[model samples]
Target: MVQNLSTLQLLLIVGGGIAYTVGIPVLVKRRPDPWPKTFGYHEIWHVITVVAATMHFTAVSDVLA
Candidate 1:
């Protein structure tokens, strides 16, 4: 386990990180306005990030001895 997280956990953490890096920036291009007060797409991205992190942390299992 790296940093006490198992292999699968690490993969998920890394995958999520990659997805966040590639996904969030493209949000602006996907939408015509990309305004929080208007369409709220940016705000939705932020919420997705928070939820992903929460799921990763909560789902991490203990390392086998």
Candidate 2:
């Protein structure tokens, strides 16, 4: 199945996976202090998640279309 993927598609999928794997642990381990008062780890995690999802979506759409 992987052999069918174009290089760009493979890269996007792998990159997204890597982002999620890296981001979640960092988000957990370095949670912000004063949890209600500042823009911090959670916000950064959300952005990373969005970017990762976008990368995954791009890859899936390219493959499906």
Candidate 3:
């Protein structure tokens, strides 16, 4: 079925892409407090990135013919 991209979905795809992209360097070079090295900051950030990418893909795909 053909579908169109909605505003929220578009925003999510764009925002999630930006966050997923920007979050990496920030999480790597300069991690926030309360999430020490032992807490797997990079790993957790990667998981978040995967989730965001998945969301972006799912939303974009839904709008395709």
Candidate 4:
């Protein structure tokens, strides 16, 4: 159980980092225009970040528990 949680935590952190660093930048460069009242790539990036953080927190809590 501990080993599984550790692996999951590591994967989430690395995956989130990659998404933030590479995926978000690519999307921003590809679509440099805001769609519908200033909601743009940056906003999308933030949403993804929040989701990733939430998932990470959940995994960590589970591991600790």
> Relative to the true structure, how large is the alpha-carbon lDDT of every model?
0.62, 0.87, 0.72, 0.66
Considering only N, C-alpha and C atoms within 3 Å, which residue pairs clash in candidate 3? none
> What is candidate 2's TM-score against the reference?
0.84
lDDT for 43 in candidate 3 is: 67
Best by TM-score: 2
Q: Mark the regions of model 4 whose C-alpha exceeds 4 Å error after superposition.
A: 1-23, 26-36
Model 3 alpha-carbon drift over 4 Å, by segment: 1-4, 33-38
- Whole-model lDDT, model 1: 0.62
Task: Indicate the residue-level lDDT of 40 in model 1.
Answer: 67
Clash totals in order: 0, 0, 0, 0
Error of 2 at 48 (Å): 0.7
Q: Scored by Cα lDDT, where does model 4 land?
A: 0.66
Give the local distance difference test score of model 2.
0.87
All candidates: TM-score: 0.45, 0.84, 0.59, 0.55
Ranking by TM-score: 2, 3, 4, 1
Give the higher-TM-score candidate: 1 or 3. 3
Model 2 is weakest, by summed lDDT over 10 consecutive residues, at 30-39
Tell me the tens digit of each residue's lDDT in model 1 across 1-65. 47777667777777667757655765766543457576666666666677667646644532332
